[model samples]
Structures are given as structure tokens and as C-alpha cells.
Target: MFLFKRPLISALFRRKIQYPKSLNIKPLITFQINKMSTTVTIPEKQSVIYYDKTGGPEVLQFSTDFPVPSDLASNEILVKNRYSGINYIETYFRNGIYPASFPYIPGREASGEIVAIGSDVKNFKIGDKIAYLGNQNFAQFTKLDSNKVSIINVGANATDDQLKLYAASLLQGLTAITLINEAYNVKEGDYILVTAAAGGVGLILVQLLSKIKKAHVIAVASTNEKLNKAKVNGAEFLLNSSELSYDQIADKILEITNGKGADGIFDSIGKDSFEMDMKSIKRKGTIVSFGNASGAVSPLSITRLSPKNVKIARPQLFGYVTEPEEFQFYTESLFDLIKNGDLKIDIYKVYALKDYKTATIEMEGRKTSGKILLEIPN
Candidate 1:
């Protein structure tokens, strides 16, 4: 296995800030008040797409009529979201692929600007550009905790709203870093297999492992186009996942390794690919089952984890970000990498917030390459 950097030093972890907040960057709600709803026009209220009974895209509805705060609470920042990033997770929320509390709004990653700051909030002021990750991201104006946002500087060419919304590209990077760093403690010389290797988090994970963890990334994808995406992300090898049986795919990995299997496998396509992952992993290998794109896996058995001493565990981004130390330890590196060009995020499609059905259709059809954004009209 290939590795980079030696005697890995302790990395400083940073806490997560915010996302949908990264979309619309409003000017300071107040010049000197330090807090309060920036006192804006249009009633300081906005629109959001929501669903009561979840099933399919048709179940979604655009709501020009939505609720806004009667008062800004302490430590809260009212963000005027311009564009929100639509993710597969949101689709799962909407389509009931993953069950949620009824009548919940979807959309997770968004970038915006501060419009209102609670009186007790000091870390941020109104009008600052920020990116936030949380529920209720489909809303035009989102009130997020002051501490859950990250300040961003827009380029000269991009408007404040554009820049802030673009910041949502970092969501997968943040998630990927957290997944690799904590969920597995992935180390140098680790030969990791990334399934759905061309998808948002999959590509980001390949990049992080290649650039940060210095691991050998063997990317597995269903299409050549996706394989190319993995290639750009620093994949050491690419395996086409089409027209091949699970056993044949495992055989290919062994061929690539001269009979030795991968050290770690990140399986996202749930049941359709879980058994293959088990066959391809090396002895004492680790399997990080993250998503169930194909369908969730079945009951676990001791035989699945025994004999080879293989370690299998499922970890999600929310699991890591809830902790301050782990959150910072991972996310800070993501931004730094983006600023320095060590990572890349595709802004493949932008949709109007009301057009969520269209976005979800394209996303579920696998007709996209990177994070899709929903622009909430200002």
C-alpha cells in the first residue's frame, strides 16, 4: 500500500460552524446594536419548501407562506439564505427512504449571511458570510446558533450571496474528513476501497485520504465517468463495478494487489455490495458502512465479522460533529484544503428552492456529479 508523510502528528480538530447559513449573506441587521433581526424589509421573513406526508417528489410543496421569528433568541443568528445545497440525505428525508418526524423540512447544507444576531451572541455579527449544516436548510431565512457558523470571505467577482452559497461545497469535505479521521482512525499505508467513488462524499473521501491521510485509494464505481471523477480525486486505482458479480469484483481486487486484498473498505451501496466488501477486505481489515444507496444490509452474524478478524462499523457525519473536539479536528482541515487547492467540490447544478422536485429527480437518477444547490430567491 502507498502512504505519504510519516509519524503522523496529532491534528488539531475544530468544531463545526454552520451551513444553510452559508447561502444568503445579509448585511448586518443592525450597525451597532450587536444583536437583533438586523431590522430588514419584507418582514424579515422568507419562504421554505416542506412536506407533511412523505412519499415522493409530488408530496413536496413550495410555501411562500412560512413562519419567521417574532423575536430573536439569545445566541441565535438569523441567516438570509440565498441558495441551499440539495443532498441525497435530503431526498431520503423527503421520499421517506429514511423515516423522519412527520412534516419536517429537508435540505442539510446551505450557505447564507447573518441577518439577525441574538443579544447574547458575540462570536458573529449581522451580514457576515457563513455556511451552516443542519435541518430546515430549505428555508430562505434560517436562525442558527451563532457558534455554529463559519465566517467566509467572498472573492471580488462573486456577490456575497453567491460566495456564501458556494461555501456549501465544503459539506462533503467536512463529512469525509470526520468519517475517515474518527470513524476509523485511517492511517498511512491503508489501502482503502471507496464505493460510489464518484459521488459527493465518496470523491471527497478519496481526496482526503490521498492528500491528508496519505492512503492508497482504490475507487470502485458503476460508470467510467464516475471512475474519472475518482481519478481526479487521487485514486491510485479504479475498478469498474458494472457487469461484474460480487465474486468477480473481489477477484479483480486481488489481481490488482497480486492476491492481497484491501486494508479498509467503505461500502455505501448497502445490500447490493456488502458481501463483495466482505470478500475483498484483507485480514484484520476494517469496513466502514456509511450509506445504503442500494438498500440497507440485513441482520449481522458473528461469521460475517469473524475468521479474518475484520472490523465493520457504520459511522455518519452527525455522529462526529456533535462533539466539539472531533468536529474541529476534522472540519478545519477541509477549509484549509479548499483554500489551498488540495481539494475540489463540484457545483454541478443549481435549482430554485421551489424546484426541489426537479433537483431530487436529477439527483436520484444519478444525473449529477457533485453537490447540487437550491437557490432561495432573495
Candidate 2:
């Protein structure tokens, strides 16, 4: 009886079994695995800001019944966002200067906790706090690839407010670090000019250049109050653009540099400052244009850079940290700076989620100085 049963089982296992072609298999497999995995009850709907067309800030519409995303792909994790950072790039998308799909959500980074994760995800579990860089973060829940998520490992005893500060600082902090390291390497004693020096990225750049890289920073801003703020952040020289014309600012930069222009110029005010950048940068200097606040820089003849033998770079933060290892290295470096008191994060304001439109308007108007954030209600 035992021999007969053994042969019968072996034959059955050896037989080829074919699944029906009409049956979708991937979700079925995921469902079977999820039944055995850890998960929390997630809401089916969430509050979100979305737009079907690109225009001014008025195009954004808030909805409390927007569907929550549940169909996470194999390397994705679902995050219940607590805070989202507002950036100038979002305004570019809203104004149609940057192409985006309709029904688009307009946020780039957020901090949250993992509520659900796909079967193949590793090193992360449900309920782990994280801050991630991804799109569609204006919603309460965001689906992100595991690679884009960074665990909030500030400390075991860190408070919720401290975590929120980390979230607000991540995107802009990473941008500043990469710009100084990769966009143009800032050497010790390098005369660097940072435009828009009171903005989110500007303040970080000023700190990294003066404090970390040991370079002399010449900060440029639109107002004296803003310049004072930049000075407190470690800028050695301050140029008030509102009080000085572009050429005058260039002249002052040269005058401060002992008749030689700045060795590097980091310009965030796009078209309106390009001429000033060209004039302020010294021979063999590099110009790093990383934003479009005043407007996109117009086309120029390549030969224009020939006279000074200058190097110009247009770098985006995402381009510099595409690999997971690159992201981790820069993120860890940024957090280390924050932890050691080498970098200070200033939150301009934390607006309620409903006030996203007002936040956008204020940031676009250049009325805010530091990082702007939106609080996502649980």
C-alpha cells in the first residue's frame, strides 16, 4: 500500500499542469502572499490636490474623496504622508513650463510611514517611518519605489517634530550638496557667488560653501532683509540685487574679489541673472544654473563662453543621484551635517494641506525665505 501511494504521488508531481490563459496570475500570486504578510487597514479614499490642466495656482483643486492608491507594484511601498515640501519646481509644472500629465499631483517630496508594501520589498516593513523623494506627494498616501525611500534613522529618541524637520530639509539639502560637489567642485578659498541666496536651496548652499567647503561666499538676494539672513547662514559678502543693477552687482563682485571675478557662480534666478553670471564669473570659471525662478534662461551662442574659456552646467538634482547608492551616500551626508550642527534647516512656514494654494502663491511671489511645507493630516 505504501509503494503504490508513493508512485501515485510522484507521477502526479511529474505531470505537466497548465494554468488557463484567461486567468491573470500575478495579482493572484500577490494576493496569496499578502494573506500571509503583515498589513494595516488602509483607507480606500484620501484627501488630495490634483489638476486636470496646467495653469496658475488656481488650476489646483482639492478633493477629500480622491481614491487612495492600492495597486502597488513589486518594488513599491505605500506611505501615509505626514508632511510634504513645496518647491519652485512645482510652480514650473503648474504653469506648463514643465510638461506633466493631466490630473497631475504637484509635490516632489514627503515624510510618512509605511502602511503597506509589495511582496518583493526588503529591509522595510509596515509602520517604518520614512522620508521619500517621489511624485504625487500632495496626497495623504503616496506609492513609492523602495529605492526612493529613506528610512528616518535620525535617532531612536528623535521626536516627531524633529522628523518633520528632516523631511522638510531632505530635498533642498540634497540639491545643495550635489550642486556644490558635482555641479561645480568648490575648493577651499574659492570665491563663489550664490544667487537667490535667501531661498531654500540658497541658504543650504551658503552654509555648505562657507562652513563645509571653507570657501568665501558672496550671497546675492532681492532684499536687504534676505541678505542679512544669508549673512547669518555664513555668507561673507552680500549683494542686494534690488539696490544694484546686474552690471553693478557684477562690478561689486569683481571689486570684492580684488579685480578678479568669482571663481564659480551658482545662479538660481534663471534668465534675469544669466548676463550677471556671465559678467561676474572669472576666466576659466564655471556657472551652475540650477533653477528658473525669474524664467528659463534664453538660448545663447556657445561662442559666448569662448571669450573667457568658461564652463557652464545646467544640473538637476535627480540627475546627480540616480543610483540608489548615490542617493544613500548624499542623504547620509546631509543628515550627518544636520546632526552635527554643521547645517541649520529653517522652516519658513508649515501650511495646512488646504492652504496649498496660498503656499504656492507666496513661494512664487518670493515672499518666503526658508523651506515651505504642507502638513498632511492623518
What TM-score, computed on C-alpha atoms, does each candidate reach? 0.84, 0.88
Q: Best-fitting candidate, measured by lDDT?
A: 2
Residue lDDT tens for model 1, 117-181: 77766656566666667668788887665555333323224465455435556567676776776
Error of 1 at 35 (Å): 8.4
Indicate which candidate wins on TM-score. Answer: 2
In model 2, the clashing pairs are none
lDDT, model 1, position 92: 63
Global CA lDDT computed for model 2: 0.80
